[model samples]
Target chain A: MKAITVTNPDDPSSLELTEVDTPQLRDGEVLVKVHATSVNRADLLQAKGNYPPPKGASEIIGLECAGVIEDPGTTGRTTGEEVACLLSGGGYAEYVAVPEGQLLPIPEGYSLSEAAAVVEVACTVWSNLGMLAGVREGQTVLLHGGAGGIGTFAIQLCKQLGATVAVTAGSAEKLETCRKLGADILINYKEQDFAEELTGRCDVILDIMGAKYLEQNLKSLNVDGQLVIIGMQGGRKAEINLGALLPRRLSVRGTTLRARSVESKAEVVRSTVENVWPLLDDGRVTHHIHTTLPLADAAKAHALLDSGEVTGKIVLEVGEV
Target chain B: MKAITVTNPDDPSSLELTEVDTPQLRDGEVLVKVHATSVNRADLLQAKGNYPPPKGASEIIGLECAGVIEDPGTTGRTTGEEVACLLSGGGYAEYVAVPEGQLLPIPEGYSLSEAAAVVEVACTVWSNLGMLAGVREGQTVLLHGGAGGIGTFAIQLCKQLGATVAVTAGSAEKLETCRKLGADILINYKEQDFAEELTGRCDVILDIMGAKYLEQNLKSLNVDGQLVIIGMQGGRKAEINLGALLPRRLSVRGTTLRARSVESKAEVVRSTVENVWPLLDDGRVTHHIHTTLPLADAAKAHALLDSGEVTGKIVLEVGEV
Candidate 1:
């Protein structure tokens, strides 16, 4: 099987297309002929030796993929079933083994490439905003990186949940993209302080910047508000005033989908499929693919995503669709 | 009516018994002729002008009292109902007005003073452990300030919930007290590093030390663990490593029962009574009162509690039982 492997772990740009042994199917796992996989920030970290796959996970570099099962091992399932997978690793390959629980039916009418792009973002957003924060009607949600893959999907989902959506992006074009996706308040973080603009108003905040926005995110929340941190793009440590949190009944939660156990991943996949698939099928939420490239160009895809200009997801086509 | 007033806001020791007008009931309120009121740490802060009562709450000090209803305002209830009242303020008086929803039935086989001691602690522990943390059988809970008012009660309640209880206290004797209350693990905080002793073990932590233990508390939680901060006895600011929180999927929530709305209090009161009162009725959980003093001795009671010599609660007997 062909896979994208980092030729030199020290250099993320050294991603190379190379021959690797096909993954063996473990019990309750199925071997999938991967059609498409998407790039995530964590993939770049793994390529640079910063992020490592969880123990017993694939050493390959992708968090999500879409394909058809080639061999249904141990588990009683027919081959040739189309599925999108929430992967711990091993997605940037022609063949990947997926635990049964991590599999989701591709949304109705979605191509494999589109399905790949939405799997990670859909599960991440829904798990945090829906499962953790319990975002619902009449609430206000502030989404950081508003035009990015997770943010774009989160904005749509929050709107679908009957919430007022606020977004922070670096430029007018990104903010415009968020506006088209049902965002109610748009703040160009380059010019305005989001915390000041939405002071004590948001019921939930989907934060990616981590420590840099920690204080501001705390300040932006209303009484009983929750801040869910999924990434630490802007560094990882900051001073917190626990005093402020008590009187306001605020909660700060930190989570990573890739770090979750197989059972946890299965639960997230099941919930995301149950709650989010309908919206995608109905076109209420749409996949935002910035670009798609051949699997061999995984390095280029990583570079493009790192440049930070691309909106939504970048996909790498691996096998026959 | 006679109430304990702060003779000098600058001096918490200046509590004096004085004649004051009886409280006029607001709509949906009931006036209670106080029989027993318990001294809480918050009362000391209020006397020192540090803690202010919530809007529309009484300006006097005291958070919990057990008394008979003198007047059931417009809600159409009979007077003379024996109730354990959760109050915002004015408990250290001959008469106090309480929102009807904040009333709890006196636990079976308990005296007025015993009932008063359990009200705030029961509501606080139940709201955090039961409603917020959802502590269940086999989970591990860490209670800080073991043998203090909240800790002594929480230790027993966690046991009733079938959880493994760990506690951190300042002395060997306090730890012994915690062990007697069914704590499975006891750490003398003065002699041991609790985080080191319980690293990645606590499913829920009821914290009071705030910034002082913030980092350690974060380190001591298991995956999917929740740290509910109900008090900030140690200073309020600390540096947090958000990076550490994500992979473990930890959450930190801060809450003060006094800061909650009357409706929220009602919900908490209702839930506590439904779930916890049964434990009290069966003697599975018992109130621990260190001592009871005449209402006029509130200043002395506060002094004793502040001295950290009193375990359980210090009750101030306000009127004839």
Candidate 2:
């Protein structure tokens, strides 16, 4: 099996396409021949030695993949069924073994590479926006980083839930993409202040820029509002004004899906398949792929993500299953 | 009607016992002839012109009272019924007009003066700890300011709900009082560091020190724990470490019950009467009073509270109803 490994651990150019042994099946686990996998920010962090995989998981970098079952270990599914999976690690290899419960059949009529992009965004949005923040109908949602994969998926899902969606992006092109995704209010963050534009109206805010936007994110919140932070693209430390927070009855929750227990990850996967897969199957939500590259050009994918030029997801086609 | 008026906002000595006009009733409101009223920290802040009453509330001090219903308005209860009430203001007067929904029947076998202390502490604990933070059985709760009204009420309520309660106080005597109230873990905040005493174990934290304890309170939380801030006694600004908060999956909420809408307050009152009244009736929860003073010595009551020598609560006996 061929895998993408970090040879230097200090530079983006350190990735090497090297031959590795196939992973063996554990109890209640099945092996899958990798078809395609998408690149996430966590992959880049792991490549640069900043983020480590959870204990007892594979040391490989990928977090999600779309593949076909090769060896079914005590499972009901037959051989060669196309599936999308959420992995703790080991998604970067040619063959991977995962818990049977973490696999979901590809949505109707979607290609394998497109299904690879669906699992991460679907589970992230479902767990944070739907389950944690409890986004409801007739409420307003303020989504930051509106051109990214999570942002694009969240905007469409929130609209599908009968909510009014607001988005903040850095460019006209990005704002246009958000507008086409059914965003009700669009603000160019470089040109307009989001807090002033939607002060005292937002019921939930899906935030990515953590410390830099904490104050303004709180100011944009109405009473009984909740702000869920899933990324810290900005710096980590910030001053908080409890005086403003207490009187407004605000809630701030910080979470990430990468380090969760595999059981918890399986729960997220099951929920995403049940609630969000139908939206994908009916054409209400679609994949937004920027570009696809061969698995050998893994370093280029990291560079493109760092440049912030790509909208939506970037996929890597591994090989024929 | 005789009321306690602030002759000068700067001096506690400026509160004078004098005659004032009785309040007129608004729609959905009832008038009560005061038998007793209790003091709160908010009353002190209002006297010093630091905290102002909410809009449409009376300018006089006092937050809770026990009295006889003078006029029932449209309520089902007849006149002259003994009731414990949570007031927006005007509890310092001989007569007060309150929303009929805020009225509670004095618990079985409790005196009027004791019931006066119940409304403020009961409503505060039930709203912040039980409702907002969602404290449940078998979880651990860490409460700050263990000697005061909210803490005393919270200890008993948490114990009744099968939770393990932890408390912090400034003196040995205060800790002893908390122990009798069913606090399982005791930390003298003056001599011991609470964060070191209970790190990564608290399920919910009911905090009043605000900025001073923000970092420590967050450290005290276990994974998926919640910290609810109800008062800002320590300070109003602090630095938050999002790096620490995100990975642990913690929630921080800031709330205060005094400035909420009448409809919202009615909902909280309804929940309290339905869920908490039974405990009071069964003798599982009881009011703790430290002293009683004549209503004419309202300024002396304030002084006793400021001195930090009083334990439980200080009641002002207004007159015979």
Candidate 3:
């Protein structure tokens, strides 16, 4: 099987297309022929020797992919079924083994490439906003990185949940993209303080710039508000005033999907499929793919994502149908 | 009516029993003839002009009291109904107006003074551990100040919930008290590091030492653990490693019951009565009062709690039932 392997971990851009052994099907797992895989920030960290796969998971670099079952393994399932998979690792390969629970039926009309782009963002957003925060109607949700993959998806979902959506991005174009996706309030973080603009108004905040926005995120929340931090792009440590939280009944939570146990990922996949798949199928929520590249240009894909100009997901096509 | 008033803003011990206007009941409220009120740490802060009552709440100091209804204004309830009330303020008076939603039935086989001691602690512990943390059987809960008011009650509730309870206190005697209350693990904070002993083990931590235990509390939790900070006894600011929270999926929440609105308090009161009242009725949970004092000795009650020599609660008897 062909896979994207790190040639030099010290250099994050040293991803190379190389031959690797095909993944063996573990019990209750099925071998899938990966058609497309998408780049995630975690993949960038893994390449730089910062992030490591969870125990008993693949050492490969992708977190999500769209693929077709090649071998059903010990689980009783039909072979040749097309599916979108949430993976711990191994998606950056021609062949990947997926636990049965991590598989989702590709949304009604989605191509494999589009399906790949939706898996991580869909599961990530829904798990945090829907499962953890229990975002509901009449609530105000603040989304950071508004035009990015997760943010774009979340904006639409929050709107569907009957919430007022506020978004923060670095530029006008990104903010405009968020507005088009039904964001009610847009703040260019480069010029305005989001906390000041939305002070004590947000019911839930989907934060990616961990420590950098920690205080501001705390300040931006209303009474009984929740701040869910999924990524730490800005840094990782900050001073917190627990005093600020008590009277307001505020909460701060940090979560990562990849490090979760297989059972947990299964639960997330099940929920996303149950709740989010219908929206995708109905076109109420749409995938935002910034660009698509052939799997052989693995190094170039990493560089493009590193530049940070991409508005949404960058998909890598691994195989033809 | 007679109430305890702060004689000097600068002096925390300047509590004086004096004649005051009887509280007039608002719509959907009830006026109660206070029989017994229990001293809370918040009362100490309120006396020093630190913890002010919530908006529209009484300006007097006291959070929980057990009394009989004198007037059931607009609420259409029977006058003279014996109730345990969760109050925002004015519990130190001979009469206090309470929102009908915050009233609780006196626990079976309990005296008015005993019922007063259980209100604040039961509601605080249940709201945090039961509603917020969703603590269940097979989980491990860590209670700080284990022999104190909240801790002693929480220890028994956790045991009844079939959870393993760990506690931290300052002395051997306190730890012994916690053990007698069904705590499985005990750490004397003066001699041992609680985080070191319980590292990566706690599923839920009921914290009072805020900023002081913030880092250690984070370190002591297992994956998907929750730390509910109900008090800031140890201070309120601390540097948090957001990195530590992400992969482990930890949450930190701060809450104060006095600050909640009537509707929210109603929900909590309803839930507590439905779930916890049964425990009290069945003798599965019991109130632990350290001492009883005359209502005029309110100043002395606050002083006793502030001295850190008291365990459980100090009940201030305001009138004969």
Model 1 C-alpha lDDT versus the unseen true structure: 0.93
In the range B109-172, model 3's lDDT, one tens digit per residue, is 9999999999999999999999989999999999999999999999999999999999999999
Q: Provide per-model DockQ scores.
A: 0.94, 0.85, 0.94
| Model 2 spans with C-alpha error above 4 angstroms | A74-79, B74-77
Clash pairs for candidate 1: none
DockQ of 2: 0.85
Give the TM-score comparing model 2 with the true structure, all chains together: 0.96
Candidate order (TM-score): 1, 3, 2
- TM-score of every candidate relative to the true structure: 0.98, 0.96, 0.97
lDDT of 1 by residue, B29-142 (tens): 999989999989999889889899999989989999998999998876689889999999999999999998999999999999899999999999999999998999999999
TM-score for the B chain of model 3: 0.99
Point out the worst 10-residue segment of candidate 1 chain B by lDDT: B312-321
Give the Å shift of residue A9 in candidate 2: 1.9
- Which 10-residue window in model 1 chain A sums to the lowest lDDT? A312-321
What does the lDDT read for residue A267 in candidate 2?
Answer: 82
What overall lDDT goes with each candidate model? 0.93, 0.89, 0.93
Which 10-residue window of candidate 3 chain B scores lowest in summed lDDT?
B312-321
What TM-score applies to chain A of candidate 3?
0.98
